[model samples]
Target: MATLRKRNGRWQVQVRRQGFPIQSRSFRSKADANEWARLIERQQDRQELGPDRKALKSITLAHLVARYRDEIVPQKRGSAVETILLNRFLRYPICQKTLNDLTTADFAAYRDQRLKEPKHRSDKPVTPKSLKRELSPLSHMFRHAVVEWEIPLRNPLDGLKLRVVDNKRERRLLVGELDRLLESTKKGRNKLVAPIILFALETAMRRGEILTIQFRHVDFGRLSLVIPESKSGYSRVIPLTRRAVAILEALRLEDAKPTDLAFPITPIALRLQWDRLTARAGIDGLNFHDLRHEAISRLFELGLTVPEVASISGHRTLAQLMRYSHANQETVRTKLQGPETGESSHH
Candidate 1:
C-alpha cells in the first residue's frame, strides 16, 4: 500500500507491506516519488529489503528454540534436562508469535497458566521452583541469541517477575534409613551406588559434581578432594572426613588413570538404580538430593561455620546454604544444653 502527501513543497510517498517495516521516500516530482514507492513495495513483498526485519518477521520463537537446542544445548553440562525443557517449550502457544510480535506479556501469561496446571504426567502441582528451572535454559537461549547470534532483541525474560517459591526439602534420612538403603544396593551387580550414597552424605556434593570427579582431584596427603568443576564453575577443596577418605580409597581402581571418572556409572543409570534401591529399602519420600541437605545440616551440627560449609557445598550465599540445612528440635535442644553453655534463667 502507498500513501501520497505533500510536505514542505516535496512530494512524499510511503509504502507499506505485511510482515515488513513501512518505508518512505520524498521527491521533487510526484512521478519520481510514485516510482520510488512502487519499487520499494515490490522489494518488501519479495522479502528482499531490510533483511533483519524480514528475518525477524518470518521466524517464530519456536524455530529459534529448535536451533538453540540442536546447536547449543549439547555443549552444556545439564543438556539432558535442558533439552527436555526446550522441547516442551517449543509446544507452548507463545512460541507461535513471531520475533517482532513477542513481548513480556506473552511469557507472563505462560508462567501463570503453567503454575495452575498439574505437572506433566503427575498429580503434583507445578511449582515455582520447577518453573524457574524450566525457564533457566530458555533464558540462556535468549541471551545466546542476542549476544552471540546477534538476534537484535532484548531477552523477553529480562523484566518478567517470577513468583516467590520455597521448594527446599528438609527431608533428611531417618534413623536406620541409610543402613537399609546401603543394604538394598548390595544385591545389585553394580557396586558403586552404595559408595556414591556414602560419598554424597560425606561431602555434600551434587550428583552431577560427584559423577564428574576424577582420581586426580583427590589429595590424600591433605585429606581433601578438589571439585575441579562445580555448579559455580570454579574449583574448591573440600576437607575429607576419615570415613569419606576410606570410602574413596576402597573405590579407587589400582589401574585407574588420573582422567578416568572415579564413579564410572552414567547419570541415567544411577537415577534408575536409586529409585529401585529406595523402593526395596521401603524408604518413603526420600530423594537422592536429600543426602546433600543432610550433609550440610550435619556439618553445622559439627560446629562448622557458615563460610566453611558453603565452600564445601558450593553454595554462593549463606541464605541458600541455610535453606538446605535444617536442625531438628532435639538437635537444637542438645546444642542449648551443651557443656559450653552458661546457666539460663527466665527473662
Candidate 2:
C-alpha cells in the first residue's frame, strides 16, 4: 500500500507491505510517486515485496561448502590449498546439517570429535587454532549467502564460545632447531623441500608465496622479487639479503623449463616431506608456517623496527607481527642488562 503526500511543495509516497515497515521517498511529481507505488503494488500481488516474504530454504553445510569451493575459492590467493584443508577437515558427518541446525553444541561436538579422530592419534590432537582455520570457510559462505543470495540466517556461530588460540605456543624454532632442520632438510624425502627450506629461511616468505614465485617476477639486477598480490592485497617488493641473493643466483642457473614453477609441488607433498625432515632432524611438531615466524623473530633481534620487518614480511599490522616478535627469556634478560649491572651471567 502507498499514499502520496505533499511536503514543502513536493510530492512523496509512503509504501508498505504486510509485516514490513513503511518505506517513504520524496519525488518531483505525483506521477513519479505513483509509479513507484504501482511497482510495489505489483510486487505485493506476486508476494515478492511484502514483509511476510521469506528467503530461500536453509542449505546444508555440505552444499554451502561445495558452492564455496566452486564459486569462491578459485578467485582467492591460496584457494587450492585452502580448499584441500577445508574439505579434508570440515567434510563428512557435520556437513549434512543445515546452517540453522549448526548449534553451539554441534560446534563443541565437532571440536571434540576432531580432537579424538584416530587419524591424529599418533600426533597431538587438532588444536583449536587448526579447527578455527577449518571453520573459516563456513563463516564466509554463510555471510555471502545471507547478503547476496537472500538466505535468512540465524548465524549459527553467533555467541558460540570459541577456544582461545595460543599462537605464541607454536611459532618459533628453539635453539639448534634451525640448524638441525637445515641438516634434516638435506636428507628430506622430496628433492623440492630442500630448496623450499633454503628459500623460506632466506626470504621469510609464506609457503604459498614461495611456491607461486615465477622466474620472470624476480628482478635479478635489482635483487628484488615483485610479489604481485600478497595477503595484504598489495604488491610487495622482497629485497633479497646477500644469502637470499646467493640462493636466487643458484636457482637462476637451474636447467628447468622457463615456465615451470621454481618449486612445482603440492602442499600435501610438502607436508609429507616436512614430516620426514623433522623425523631426521630429531625434532617434532613444527609446521612450515613456523619458518615465517623464525624469519620475523630474527628481524626484531637484529634491531629492525616492527615497520621495517613488516616491509619484507608483508605484515600490514604491528599488532599482528608483535605475536611473532616473542623474544625468549635470554633475549629479554639481555635487553635488561646495563653498565650498572656489569653484565651479570644471570638475571
Candidate 3:
C-alpha cells in the first residue's frame, strides 16, 4: 500500500508492506512522488529490497572512505599518499551522497573538477596521471565496500573512463651534468646529498629504498645489499659497484648501530637539500628520480639483457623496464656507427 500527501508545498510518498520496513521519499511533484512509491512497491512485491538498500541509505561515501582509510590504507605500500588522497576525496561534494545515491555521473564530475584544479605550488592544472593516482584508492575502496564490507551497490567508478594523457619521462643525465651536480652538493649544507645522488645513479634505487637502507642490510663481503622490502613489495639483492661500495664504506660509522639508517635524512630534508643543490648547480628540469632512469639506461648500454637489468632495477615487467631505459642519441649513434659484421661486411 502507498500514501501520497502534500507537506510544506512538496509531495511526500510513503510505501508500506507487510514484511518490509516503510519506505518514504519527498519529491517536488506529485507524479515524481507517485513514481517513486510505485517503484518501491513493485520492488517490494518482487522481494528485491535487500539489506544493502537499507544500509546504503544510512551510509555516506565519506563514511566508507573513513572506514577504508582506517582499516585498509594502513596496509598499503603507499599508505601515506593514499591517506592524503582519500582525505581530499572526503572533502568533495560527492562524499555527501549516500552510496546508493552515488552515480557514475558524480564520479565523472569529480574527475572534471580534479582536472580543472591547479596543482599545488604550480600554475598548471592537475595532470591525468595525478587524477589516476587519486582515483585508484577510491576505486579500491568501492571494491572493498561491495565485496568485503558487503555493501550492496555497484561501484560507481566502474565503466567511467579516464582520459589519461601519457607523460612518461625520458629524461637522461647529460655528460658532465652529474659531475657538476655532485660538485654543487659538496657546497651545500648536507654532505649526504652528493653520495645519495651518486648511489641513486649507481644502484638505481628509489629515494625511499635508498633512505631505508641500514648497515645490517649491506653485505660488503658479497658486495650486495639485501633490500628486505621495496616498492614492489618484494625483497631483492642489488649488486654493489666498486664506487658504491667505497661510498658505503666511507660512510659506515664505527659506533653505529645495526638498525641505524645508512642515510639518516628524512625524505623532506632530502628534497630540500636536492632543490638547493640543483639551484646552486644551475641544473634545470632534472629530478632525483631521473638518476634512476639514467642508471637503468646505463645498464642497458653495458650490454645487460632486459631480464638482467630488471633484476637490478626491481621492475616486475619488461615493459616497465623499457620505460625507464631511454638510450641517449650519442649512444645510439655510436652503436649505429660501429663496425659492420657477418655477411654484410664480407660484401
Which wins on TM-score, candidate 1 or candidate 3?
A: 3
Tens digits of per-residue lDDT for model 2, 106-210? 877777887666444255666667777777777787777656654545456655566765747445788998789777776655677777887897788988788
In candidate 2, which residue ranges exceed 4 Å CA deviation?
A: 1-59, 89-91, 98-105, 118-121, 253-260, 324-347
Q: Which runs in model 3 stand beyond 4 Å of their true positions?
A: 1-51, 183-191, 268-282, 324-347
Report the C-alpha lDDT of model 3 over 1-347, residue by residue, as the tens digit.
89999999999888875435778889999999988888987775454775446667888889989999999999977677678778877889999998768899999998899899998554779988888888988888887765676465677888898988797888887878988998887788888998898899899999989999999999998999999999888999989998998888889989988898899998777977887888888888788889988898888888788888888999998779767545745677877888656456553
Residue 34, candidate 3: C-alpha displacement in angstroms: 36
For residues 1-347, write the lDDT of model 1, one tens digit per residue: 89999999999898765445668888999999989998986665454675356768777998999999999999989788788788888888999999878889999999999989897545778888889888988888888876577565557898899976676678888999999998898888789999999999999999999998888998887999998788889888889989888988898878978888889888878988888898789988898999988998888888778898888898988778767445645677876878663756656
Please give the ranking of all candidate structures by TM-score, highest first, separated by commas.
3, 1, 2
Pick the TM-score winner: 3
What lDDT is reached at residue 15 by model 1? Answer: 78
Candidate 1 CA-lDDT value? 0.84
Cand. 3 TM to true fold: 0.75
Residues forming the 10-long window of minimal summed lDDT in candidate 1:
43-52
Return the clash pairs for model 2, or none.
none
Give lDDT for model 2: 0.73
